[model samples]
Target: MLVVDDNSNPFEMSCAIEIFGLARPELGRELYDFRLCAAEPETRMRDGFFTLTGVAGPEAAESADTLIVPNRPDTHVPRSQRVLDVIRRAHARGARLVGFCSGAFTLAEAGLLDGRRAACHWMWADAFRARFPRVRLEADVLFVDDGDILTASGSASALDLGLHLVRRDHGAEIANHVSRRLVFAAHRDGGQRQFVERPVPAVPDESLGPLLAWAQERLGEPLTVSGLAARAAVSPATLHRRFRNQLGTTPLAWLTGERVALACRLIERGEERLDVVAARSGLGTAANLRARLRRETGLSPSAYRKRFGAGPAQPTAAGGSGP
Candidate 1:
């Protein structure tokens, strides 16, 4: 994988290098062969305070299986044709293309995202729309995975996409292991919103913080709106209003999401029996777990476990343990 650096954000660059470039021998497989690339003579990031040298040129990307554009020089500033040509050549040769944040601008400018479902930071939706009307932008998403092409909204979404690629190539187990190594969620669907906090009030603004924690530990128990509100010492409607204002989502939706997240962890830990996984994750029945997993991850219990399950933790659904 080659990460194309074009006078951009250091944080986004670090996000990629940390996930794809760093070695994780603990996973027992060589994952990505990540590298950095520069198409020109001037080698400084966007701020010009951080200087990058010894970066490989475009020719290096030609052989890589994947190519990434971390960000554009600026959404409004035009890129040199020479750089665009190199990026196009990389795509033409069958390398997977990735663009995150304003990097989508580079893809759009190159005409790659034209008519394709793509994403960029939501705040840039209007600018992106005005600049590249041909692109079918899904601005609300955390990222977009269009087979050969992948794009992310911004910030941690960059990590989500990198981990997503890891999951794509090596399966969920390896991705989860790498995610655990980096302390990140192994998967956050591209359809999820880019930001939840509207700002003047924080997510912690007397916002069901304790109730959420309480519900997390008791997902197996029946959780109701009234029960949750009672525990928080507020009326159900007040709880709903507060959740909407502070979390940007409802309590039930948040609870279900948390349950799905827990199921992911249980599955990743390689629990063999679907029923056991279902029981412990508090989704109850295997059928219910199946339904929820598909809704959340677009994968079945067996399939999700297969992609993400790890270690000699439990007996196989068909029969025996890994060891």
Candidate 2:
């Protein structure tokens, strides 16, 4: 992987560095070989707060299997033609090109995003639309995965897309390992709309907050929307509207997702008993668990465990902060 930078945001760059740069021998082998490069050497980053030196030149991107363009300094102002030239050349070689945050503009400039759907920070939506009318700009989504050419929104969401890449390359278990190591929650297939709706930072604490907390605490107990509504002293209809307005999802679907997530967590933790996993996750019988697992993740319980479960004597130290 080649990381292209032009005064890139440190946080966005760190997302790639953490998963690809860091060493994890317990996983058996290196997951990714990463290098840092830019069109100019000793360039400033994060609005000149830091300077990157000793990075390779644009040639590094040509032979790289995956190339990343971190957030650029300005979208309206033109970046060096030399940088755009290298990006266009790399994409022609079928390299997986990713644009993080405003880096979507860099990809757009390179013509990689010309006809493909893309995503970027919502703040830059109008500028991107006005500048590149050809590209299908999805502002509401956290990220857009258009096969090899991927685009992510904002600095923080870059992590989501990076983890998603890991899941796509390896499997859910490995991706979940990376998430556990980073101390971040693993997000599912839905777009970033759910996140945008609740802006109180990680799950809101409004009217249904208490009820949501209660349901999470009792995930093993067969739950219903009406039961949750009664717990909150609201009619079922009112609760339904509240869920739709706040979480952008129906009550039962959200519950099933949570149950599936719990089951996955249990399976990933090396749970041996499938029946226990099903019962504990409130999916009832093993058949139900299998059906739900297959429906949500497209893998049966044992298959998911085999693909993503922890290996023997696996070191727990992999779960921590990245460099």
List the global CA lDDT of all models.
0.74, 0.75
RMSD after Cα superposition, model 2: 5.3
Misplaced by over 4 Å in model 1 are: 25-31, 163-189, 198-208, 241-246, 311-323
Question: What lDDT tens digits, residue by residue, belong to model 2 across residues 1-323?
Answer: 54556667888877878876777776786566677777777778878888888888777666776788757757777877888887787678767788888989989988888888999988899999999999999998778888788888877788888887776555566777788888875654436452445445333434676787789889999899888888877788977877776766678888887787788878888887988998888888889999999876678877888877776432221112111
Quick one: how many clashes does candidate 2 have? Answer: 0
Pairs that collide in candidate 1 are 172-307
TM-score of 2: 0.74
How do the predictions measure up, each by TM-score?
A: 0.79, 0.74
Give every collision pair in model 2.
none
Top candidate by TM-score: 1
Looking at model 1, which ten-residue stretch has the lowest summed lDDT? 314-323
Deviation in Å, model 1, residue 4 alpha carbon: 3.2
